[model samples]
Target: MTDSRFSCVLFDLDGTLVDTAPDLTGALNHVLSQHNLAPFSVQKVRNTVGFGARITIERSFAHYGKTLSEDALDLAHAQFLAHYSENICKNSTLFPGVDTVLEDFKSNGIRMSVCTNKTENLSLDLLEQIGVSHYFSSICGSDTVPNKKPHPDHIFSAINRAGGITEESILIGDSMADVESARAAGIPVIVMRYGYTAIPSDELGADLVLDAFSQIPQALRDLSH
Candidate 1:
């Protein structure tokens, strides 16, 4: 592969590009507290994340040894969304060296985009709040396409939205969802070991395992080769 093999870098939002677990778990705990349920720890919720808010809130309820009925789940989800939307990015921060790495990508003229399971408006709001929204040419959230991650459509759509061809794009992500989607879409993928992946990052079988954002340029080069 040559440098021309990749012209875009698609990223996973929550755990990969930013440490959103603080606000994400906080909102879940807020909803749980409303029902007099014990709150979930940030670490606990971090492990349950990557699947999206409905699932995160669902798992939080389960962690308290209680399951919600369909109607109850719906109501709880609404409450969680409301609270999360209001407090999005309150404590979230970009991972170490992300800004500098992104600047490097921009200087190299590599297009960048986001493909996340978070809903579109919420994802955009969070990115905007964190002041990195300008970095992504496209932000394809769960609702932005017909299907979400672990499905190839999400990856393809993100690349397309960024005006990059599939063969000329790679993904930097943190979960099996990212790996599976990237693989399915024939996109080379690099995983961040420090992000909120459910399984071991190495075990995810990404083209590269990046322990820090600082390793990104090298990993992208290796993947291109």
Candidate 2:
């Protein structure tokens, strides 16, 4: 195995680190059904997975020719969160090779953290439930910092919380927000091609595009140079 490119690696939580769509779809559908909207398929909802819960609920409503008032949206959002918190990991699973890749990074002395748009409490809960919380020294969520991703501070804060230096860190994620944030932070990004990104991964302008978790170490090495 080649030496890794980055001393620290930051990952995105939702579609990048885990397949969270099943439970998310359930949550979205739960809210939609409450509003008398048709339920969406897991596949249909998976397309919007990484965006966040409010947007997901909004999109689900769009499916049924309805729009919520801010008050209704807030109420629906609360209900979605409540239902989601109860079933957060019911059908979620780490992507193929994730555990193995993490173990390899650990053995290689690579510090890791999560920089996700999910709320801090939910992010932590999901990671704990899935038994991967220990792998990340820090897990910074959308609410963990003053601003969220596409904002460099979110990534910088995550790096800081992980005791990682920016010069030796890189982000591994799956969306345009991840790309832009890493760029603004002056770090290279490696995007997961299989993630739930609405656009093609290549268009995210990452330093390296990854087809699988196993490609990460090598991609890091290649990009670091």
Candidate 1, residue 153: CA error in Å? 0.6
lDDT of 2 by residue, 1-225 (tens): 466558889999888889998999888888888867778888787677666788778877876788889999999999999999999999999999999989888777788999998999999999999989989889999889998988999999999999999999999999888999999999988899988877889888998898999888778777766
TM-score of 2: 0.95
lDDT by residue for model 1 (1-225), tens? 135457888999988989999998888988888999887778777778887888877777776688999999999989999999999988999999998988888877889999999999999999888888888899999999998998999999999999988888998999888999999998888899998866888899998888899988877776665
Q: Residue 158 of model 2: what lDDT?
A: 94
lDDT of 1: 0.88
Please, what is the whole-model Cα lDDT of each candidate in the order they appear? 0.88, 0.88
TM-score of each: 0.95, 0.95
